[model samples]
Target: MSEQEFTKSLTYAPGLPKDATFYSGHKKRVTSHAVSEAAENALKERGVAVEDIAEIVFDLQTPFMAGLTMEACVENVRGALAKRELQHAILVGIELDKLAEKKMLSEPLQSLVDQDEGLFGVDETIALGAVSSFGSIAATTFGYLDKVKPKIIGRLDQEKHGKVNTFLDDIVCSIAADASSRLAHRVRDQEERRLPKKR
Candidate 1:
Protein backbone atom coordinates (compact mmCIF):
# COMPACT_ATOMS: atom_id res chain seq x y z
CA MET A 1 0.00 0.00 0.00
CA SER A 2 1.04 3.63 -0.57
CA GLU A 3 2.37 5.68 2.41
CA GLN A 4 -0.86 7.74 2.54
CA GLU A 5 -2.96 4.57 2.55
CA PHE A 6 -0.72 3.09 5.30
CA THR A 7 -1.18 6.21 7.42
CA LYS A 8 -4.96 6.10 6.88
CA SER A 9 -5.06 2.41 7.85
CA LEU A 10 -3.83 3.12 11.39
CA THR A 11 -6.61 3.33 14.02
CA TYR A 12 -5.68 5.88 16.69
CA ALA A 13 -7.24 8.81 18.50
CA PRO A 14 -9.09 11.62 16.59
CA GLY A 15 -9.04 9.29 13.54
CA LEU A 16 -9.55 12.26 11.18
CA PRO A 17 -11.72 11.34 8.15
CA LYS A 18 -12.29 7.88 9.59
CA ASP A 19 -13.75 9.18 12.86
CA ALA A 20 -17.37 8.53 11.89
CA THR A 21 -16.60 4.89 11.24
CA PHE A 22 -13.55 4.39 13.47
CA TYR A 23 -14.57 6.12 16.72
CA SER A 24 -18.36 6.04 16.65
CA GLY A 25 -20.33 3.86 19.02
CA HIS A 26 -22.25 3.80 22.29
CA LYS A 27 -18.99 3.96 24.15
CA LYS A 28 -18.93 3.84 27.92
CA ARG A 29 -17.93 7.35 28.89
CA VAL A 30 -17.62 8.52 32.49
CA THR A 31 -20.00 11.20 33.72
CA SER A 32 -18.65 14.47 35.09
CA HIS A 33 -20.46 13.94 38.40
CA ALA A 34 -19.03 10.45 38.67
CA VAL A 35 -15.51 11.72 38.04
CA SER A 36 -15.99 14.42 40.68
CA GLU A 37 -17.23 11.87 43.19
CA ALA A 38 -14.30 9.61 42.42
CA ALA A 39 -11.86 12.46 42.90
CA GLU A 40 -13.45 13.37 46.24
CA ASN A 41 -13.35 9.75 47.36
CA ALA A 42 -9.73 9.46 46.36
CA LEU A 43 -8.86 12.44 48.50
CA LYS A 44 -10.78 11.07 51.47
CA GLU A 45 -9.11 7.67 51.10
CA ARG A 46 -5.76 9.38 51.36
CA GLY A 47 -6.91 11.17 54.53
CA VAL A 48 -7.10 14.51 52.74
CA ALA A 49 -10.64 15.77 53.17
CA VAL A 50 -12.28 18.18 50.74
CA GLU A 51 -12.96 20.39 53.75
CA ASP A 52 -9.25 20.54 54.45
CA ILE A 53 -8.63 21.67 50.90
CA ALA A 54 -11.38 24.27 51.28
CA GLU A 55 -9.65 25.66 54.34
CA ILE A 56 -6.62 26.26 52.17
CA VAL A 57 -8.80 27.98 49.58
CA PHE A 58 -10.36 30.10 52.29
CA ASP A 59 -6.94 31.15 53.47
CA LEU A 60 -5.80 32.00 49.98
CA GLN A 61 -8.92 34.00 49.00
CA THR A 62 -10.70 35.28 52.11
CA PRO A 63 -8.59 38.42 52.36
CA PHE A 64 -9.25 39.67 48.83
CA MET A 65 -12.77 38.25 48.69
CA ALA A 66 -15.01 40.02 51.16
CA GLY A 67 -17.82 38.08 52.82
CA LEU A 68 -16.52 34.85 51.37
CA THR A 69 -17.78 32.26 53.80
CA MET A 70 -16.26 28.88 54.53
CA GLU A 71 -19.34 27.37 52.97
CA ALA A 72 -18.65 29.22 49.73
CA CYS A 73 -15.00 28.23 49.85
CA VAL A 74 -16.04 24.59 50.10
CA GLU A 75 -18.50 25.01 47.24
CA ASN A 76 -15.73 26.46 45.09
CA VAL A 77 -13.51 23.51 46.01
CA ARG A 78 -16.17 21.12 44.75
CA GLY A 79 -16.45 23.21 41.62
CA ALA A 80 -12.71 22.98 41.00
CA LEU A 81 -12.66 19.24 41.67
CA ALA A 82 -15.54 18.79 39.22
CA LYS A 83 -13.28 19.67 36.34
CA ARG A 84 -12.27 16.58 34.32
CA GLU A 85 -8.66 17.68 33.81
CA LEU A 86 -8.24 18.37 37.51
CA GLN A 87 -9.82 15.05 38.39
CA HIS A 88 -7.44 13.26 36.03
CA ALA A 89 -4.51 14.98 37.70
CA ILE A 90 -5.80 14.01 41.14
CA LEU A 91 -6.18 10.37 40.18
CA VAL A 92 -2.82 10.09 38.46
CA GLY A 93 -0.87 12.05 41.05
CA ILE A 94 -2.42 10.17 43.95
CA GLU A 95 -1.79 6.85 42.26
CA LEU A 96 1.88 7.73 41.99
CA ASP A 97 2.05 8.62 45.64
CA LYS A 98 0.19 5.46 46.58
CA LEU A 99 2.63 3.43 44.60
CA ALA A 100 5.54 5.08 46.34
CA GLU A 101 3.96 4.47 49.72
CA LYS A 102 3.64 0.79 48.99
CA LYS A 103 7.05 0.66 47.29
CA MET A 104 5.45 -0.49 44.05
CA LEU A 105 7.53 1.86 41.96
CA SER A 106 11.04 0.74 41.04
CA GLU A 107 14.43 1.94 42.22
CA PRO A 108 15.26 5.66 41.88
CA LEU A 109 11.66 6.75 41.12
CA GLN A 110 10.45 5.12 44.32
CA SER A 111 13.19 6.73 46.35
CA LEU A 112 12.65 10.14 44.75
CA VAL A 113 8.91 9.96 45.32
CA ASP A 114 9.27 8.71 48.87
CA GLN A 115 11.75 11.39 49.76
CA ASP A 116 9.96 13.98 47.62
CA GLU A 117 13.29 15.30 46.43
CA GLY A 118 13.58 19.03 46.03
CA LEU A 119 14.67 18.66 42.43
CA PHE A 120 11.96 16.17 41.53
CA GLY A 121 9.48 18.58 40.02
CA VAL A 122 7.09 16.14 38.33
CA ASP A 123 4.60 16.61 41.15
CA GLU A 124 4.47 20.36 40.55
CA THR A 125 4.27 19.82 36.81
CA ILE A 126 1.15 17.67 37.10
CA ALA A 127 -0.42 20.15 39.52
CA LEU A 128 0.40 23.17 37.35
CA GLY A 129 -1.16 21.46 34.34
CA ALA A 130 -4.46 21.29 36.21
CA VAL A 131 -4.30 24.80 37.66
CA SER A 132 -3.06 26.48 34.47
CA SER A 133 -6.51 26.11 32.94
CA PHE A 134 -7.96 28.48 35.56
CA GLY A 135 -5.63 31.26 34.33
CA SER A 136 -2.56 32.95 35.80
CA ILE A 137 -4.21 33.64 39.14
CA ALA A 138 -4.69 29.98 39.87
CA ALA A 139 -1.25 29.07 38.54
CA THR A 140 0.48 31.67 40.71
CA THR A 141 -1.61 30.66 43.72
CA PHE A 142 -0.52 27.08 43.24
CA GLY A 143 3.09 28.20 43.28
CA TYR A 144 2.51 30.12 46.50
CA LEU A 145 0.78 27.20 48.19
CA ASP A 146 3.55 24.90 47.06
CA LYS A 147 6.06 27.19 48.66
CA VAL A 148 4.16 27.87 51.91
CA LYS A 149 2.77 24.37 52.57
CA PRO A 150 0.10 25.72 54.89
CA LYS A 151 -2.00 23.69 57.38
CA ILE A 152 -3.04 20.25 56.16
CA ILE A 153 -0.70 20.56 53.23
CA GLY A 154 2.24 21.00 55.59
CA ARG A 155 1.09 17.99 57.58
CA LEU A 156 0.96 15.92 54.41
CA ASP A 157 4.52 16.89 53.58
CA GLN A 158 5.79 15.65 56.93
CA GLU A 159 7.31 12.19 56.64
CA LYS A 160 6.96 11.11 60.30
CA HIS A 161 3.62 9.46 59.56
CA GLY A 162 5.16 7.20 56.92
CA LYS A 163 2.59 8.34 54.34
CA VAL A 164 4.04 9.26 51.00
CA ASN A 165 2.36 12.52 50.06
CA THR A 166 4.76 13.66 47.39
CA PHE A 167 2.05 14.27 44.85
CA LEU A 168 -0.95 14.69 47.17
CA ASP A 169 0.45 17.86 48.74
CA ASP A 170 0.93 19.43 45.33
CA ILE A 171 -2.45 18.12 44.22
CA VAL A 172 -4.01 19.84 47.22
CA CYS A 173 -2.20 23.02 46.24
CA SER A 174 -3.69 22.84 42.74
CA ILE A 175 -7.23 22.25 44.03
CA ALA A 176 -7.05 25.04 46.57
CA ALA A 177 -5.50 27.41 44.07
CA ASP A 178 -8.07 26.63 41.42
CA ALA A 179 -10.92 26.94 43.91
CA SER A 180 -9.60 30.30 45.09
CA SER A 181 -9.43 31.44 41.49
CA ARG A 182 -13.00 30.27 40.94
CA LEU A 183 -14.18 32.08 44.06
CA ALA A 184 -12.38 35.23 42.99
CA HIS A 185 -14.08 35.17 39.62
CA ARG A 186 -17.42 34.43 41.24
CA VAL A 187 -17.10 37.37 43.60
CA ARG A 188 -16.06 39.67 40.74
CA ASP A 189 -19.06 38.57 38.70
CA GLN A 190 -21.39 39.24 41.61
CA GLU A 191 -19.94 42.74 41.96
CA GLU A 192 -20.34 43.38 38.24
CA ARG A 193 -23.98 42.27 38.39
CA ARG A 194 -24.64 44.56 41.35
CA LEU A 195 -23.30 47.59 39.39
CA PRO A 196 -26.17 47.40 36.91
CA LYS A 197 -28.71 47.34 39.77
CA LYS A 198 -27.01 50.35 41.40
CA ARG A 199 -27.14 52.33 38.14
Candidate 2:
Protein backbone atom coordinates (compact mmCIF):
# COMPACT_ATOMS: atom_id res chain seq x y z
CA MET A 1 0.00 0.00 0.00
CA SER A 2 1.07 3.60 -0.60
CA GLU A 3 1.26 6.31 2.01
CA GLN A 4 -1.75 8.32 0.86
CA GLU A 5 -3.70 5.17 0.16
CA PHE A 6 -2.90 3.96 3.62
CA THR A 7 -4.55 7.09 4.99
CA LYS A 8 -7.65 6.87 2.81
CA SER A 9 -9.80 4.98 5.29
CA LEU A 10 -8.29 6.78 8.25
CA THR A 11 -11.33 8.43 9.77
CA TYR A 12 -11.24 10.32 13.07
CA ALA A 13 -14.06 10.88 15.53
CA PRO A 14 -14.62 14.47 16.65
CA GLY A 15 -13.54 15.15 20.19
CA LEU A 16 -16.29 16.01 22.62
CA PRO A 17 -16.44 17.42 26.11
CA LYS A 18 -17.67 15.08 28.81
CA ASP A 19 -17.98 18.05 31.11
CA ALA A 20 -16.89 21.67 31.52
CA THR A 21 -13.15 21.11 31.64
CA PHE A 22 -12.95 17.66 30.10
CA TYR A 23 -12.32 17.44 26.34
CA SER A 24 -10.90 14.99 23.80
CA GLY A 25 -9.63 14.73 20.17
CA HIS A 26 -10.83 12.43 17.38
CA LYS A 27 -9.10 13.30 14.12
CA LYS A 28 -6.09 12.66 11.94
CA ARG A 29 -3.44 15.14 10.79
CA VAL A 30 -0.75 14.68 8.09
CA THR A 31 1.31 17.67 9.06
CA SER A 32 4.77 17.66 10.60
CA HIS A 33 7.09 15.16 9.00
CA ALA A 34 9.37 15.30 11.99
CA VAL A 35 6.49 14.34 14.24
CA SER A 36 5.65 11.59 11.79
CA GLU A 37 9.21 10.33 11.98
CA ALA A 38 8.99 10.39 15.73
CA ALA A 39 5.76 8.42 15.64
CA GLU A 40 7.27 5.97 13.17
CA ASN A 41 10.24 5.45 15.44
CA ALA A 42 7.98 4.89 18.37
CA LEU A 43 5.85 2.45 16.40
CA LYS A 44 8.90 0.56 15.26
CA GLU A 45 9.99 0.20 18.83
CA ARG A 46 6.53 -1.03 19.81
CA GLY A 47 5.88 -3.15 16.73
CA VAL A 48 2.81 -1.26 15.51
CA ALA A 49 1.78 1.29 12.87
CA VAL A 50 -0.83 4.04 12.55
CA GLU A 51 -2.54 2.29 9.69
CA ASP A 52 -2.63 -0.89 11.68
CA ILE A 53 -3.83 0.77 14.85
CA ALA A 54 -7.49 0.70 15.91
CA GLU A 55 -7.68 3.79 18.11
CA ILE A 56 -5.90 5.84 20.74
CA VAL A 57 -8.23 6.32 23.69
CA PHE A 58 -7.53 7.73 27.16
CA ASP A 59 -9.64 8.78 30.14
CA LEU A 60 -8.91 11.54 32.66
CA GLN A 61 -10.90 10.96 35.82
CA THR A 62 -8.37 12.47 38.16
CA PRO A 63 -8.98 15.43 40.45
CA PHE A 64 -7.96 18.57 38.66
CA MET A 65 -5.78 21.00 40.51
CA ALA A 66 -4.96 23.62 37.86
CA GLY A 67 -5.08 21.87 34.48
CA LEU A 68 -7.80 20.57 32.18
CA THR A 69 -8.70 16.94 31.60
CA MET A 70 -8.88 17.58 27.86
CA GLU A 71 -5.31 18.78 27.83
CA ALA A 72 -4.15 15.76 29.78
CA CYS A 73 -5.87 13.29 27.47
CA VAL A 74 -4.38 14.92 24.38
CA GLU A 75 -0.91 14.85 25.87
CA ASN A 76 -1.22 11.21 26.83
CA VAL A 77 -2.36 10.31 23.33
CA ARG A 78 0.49 12.23 21.72
CA GLY A 79 3.09 10.86 24.08
CA ALA A 80 1.91 7.33 23.45
CA LEU A 81 2.10 7.73 19.67
CA ALA A 82 5.38 9.63 19.73
CA LYS A 83 6.85 6.98 21.94
CA ARG A 84 6.16 4.40 19.22
CA GLU A 85 6.73 6.41 16.01
CA LEU A 86 3.28 5.48 14.68
CA GLN A 87 1.85 7.47 11.79
CA HIS A 88 -1.69 8.22 12.88
CA ALA A 89 -3.15 8.96 16.32
CA ILE A 90 -6.64 9.33 17.73
CA LEU A 91 -7.14 10.94 21.15
CA VAL A 92 -10.17 10.15 23.30
CA GLY A 93 -10.82 11.95 26.60
CA ILE A 94 -13.38 11.10 29.24
CA GLU A 95 -14.42 12.98 32.41
CA LEU A 96 -15.13 11.86 35.93
CA ASP A 97 -15.70 14.89 38.16
CA LYS A 98 -17.99 13.01 40.54
CA LEU A 99 -15.30 10.50 41.32
CA ALA A 100 -12.87 13.29 42.09
CA GLU A 101 -15.19 14.68 44.68
CA LYS A 102 -15.90 11.32 46.25
CA LYS A 103 -12.25 10.33 46.41
CA MET A 104 -11.25 13.68 47.89
CA LEU A 105 -8.01 13.70 45.94
CA SER A 106 -8.80 17.25 44.85
CA GLU A 107 -7.98 19.74 47.61
CA PRO A 108 -5.11 17.70 48.90
CA LEU A 109 -3.76 17.18 45.42
CA GLN A 110 -4.10 20.89 44.66
CA SER A 111 -2.44 21.97 47.92
CA LEU A 112 0.82 20.30 47.04
CA VAL A 113 0.60 21.10 43.34
CA ASP A 114 3.01 24.01 43.43
CA GLN A 115 5.16 22.86 46.32
CA ASP A 116 7.20 20.58 44.06
CA GLU A 117 7.85 18.75 47.29
CA GLY A 118 7.61 15.40 45.49
CA LEU A 119 5.71 13.84 48.38
CA PHE A 120 2.01 14.23 49.00
CA GLY A 121 -0.03 11.83 46.92
CA VAL A 122 0.10 10.01 43.68
CA ASP A 123 2.76 11.82 41.55
CA GLU A 124 2.45 15.05 39.57
CA THR A 125 5.10 13.91 37.12
CA ILE A 126 2.90 10.96 36.24
CA ALA A 127 -0.04 13.27 35.65
CA LEU A 128 2.04 15.73 33.63
CA GLY A 129 3.43 12.93 31.51
CA ALA A 130 -0.12 11.72 31.05
CA VAL A 131 -1.50 15.05 29.75
CA SER A 132 1.34 16.84 27.90
CA SER A 133 2.18 14.36 25.18
CA PHE A 134 -0.21 15.59 22.47
CA GLY A 135 0.79 19.25 22.62
CA SER A 136 -1.71 21.29 24.56
CA ILE A 137 -3.53 23.85 22.41
CA ALA A 138 -5.61 25.53 25.08
CA ALA A 139 -5.29 26.34 28.75
CA THR A 140 -7.78 23.62 29.74
CA THR A 141 -10.24 23.60 26.89
CA PHE A 142 -8.75 22.36 23.64
CA GLY A 143 -5.76 20.54 22.22
CA TYR A 144 -4.71 18.32 19.29
CA LEU A 145 -2.74 15.15 18.83
CA ASP A 146 0.22 15.53 16.44
CA LYS A 147 -0.50 12.20 14.80
CA VAL A 148 -3.47 10.21 13.45
CA LYS A 149 -5.37 7.08 14.64
CA PRO A 150 -4.12 3.49 14.56
CA LYS A 151 -1.80 4.52 17.36
CA ILE A 152 -0.67 2.08 20.00
CA ILE A 153 -1.49 3.27 23.50
CA GLY A 154 1.67 3.27 25.61
CA ARG A 155 0.57 3.97 29.16
CA LEU A 156 -3.01 3.11 30.00
CA ASP A 157 -3.02 3.05 33.80
CA GLN A 158 -0.89 6.17 34.07
CA GLU A 159 -3.12 7.88 31.51
CA LYS A 160 -6.32 7.18 33.38
CA HIS A 161 -7.22 6.18 36.91
CA GLY A 162 -8.64 2.75 36.18
CA LYS A 163 -9.35 2.09 39.82
CA VAL A 164 -11.59 5.17 40.01
CA ASN A 165 -12.39 5.74 36.37
CA THR A 166 -14.78 2.88 35.69
CA PHE A 167 -17.55 4.56 33.68
CA LEU A 168 -15.21 6.95 31.91
CA ASP A 169 -12.72 4.23 31.04
CA ASP A 170 -15.46 2.01 29.63
CA ILE A 171 -16.47 4.68 27.16
CA VAL A 172 -12.86 5.48 26.33
CA CYS A 173 -12.11 1.82 25.67
CA SER A 174 -15.00 1.68 23.24
CA ILE A 175 -13.73 4.78 21.48
CA ALA A 176 -10.25 3.30 21.29
CA ALA A 177 -11.59 0.14 19.70
CA ASP A 178 -13.40 2.11 17.01
CA ALA A 179 -10.35 4.21 16.25
CA SER A 180 -8.16 1.13 16.10
CA SER A 181 -10.38 -0.55 13.50
CA ARG A 182 -10.44 2.52 11.31
CA LEU A 183 -6.67 2.84 11.51
CA ALA A 184 -6.10 -0.79 10.65
CA HIS A 185 -8.15 -0.40 7.49
CA ARG A 186 -6.18 2.67 6.58
CA VAL A 187 -2.94 0.74 6.98
CA ARG A 188 -4.24 -2.09 4.83
CA ASP A 189 -5.17 0.38 2.10
CA GLN A 190 -1.73 1.95 2.20
CA GLU A 191 -0.13 -1.44 1.89
CA GLU A 192 -2.21 -2.23 -1.17
CA ARG A 193 -1.09 0.99 -2.82
CA ARG A 194 2.51 0.16 -2.22
CA LEU A 195 2.35 -2.75 -4.62
CA PRO A 196 4.12 -2.23 -7.94
CA LYS A 197 1.93 -1.19 -10.85
CA LYS A 198 1.48 -3.70 -13.61
CA ARG A 199 2.30 -2.20 -16.99
TM-score, every prediction:
0.85, 0.24
**Ten-residue stretch with the least lDDT total in model 1:** 1-10
lDDT of 2 by residue, 51-124 (tens): 33222432222232223244444443444444312233311111232244255446654334323233532332
Runs with alpha carbons beyond 4 Å of true place in candidate 1:
1-28, 197-199
Q: How close is candidate 1 to the true structure, as a TM-score?
A: 0.85
Clashes of 2: 31
lDDT, candidate 2, at 194: 100
lDDT scores for all predictions?
0.86, 0.33
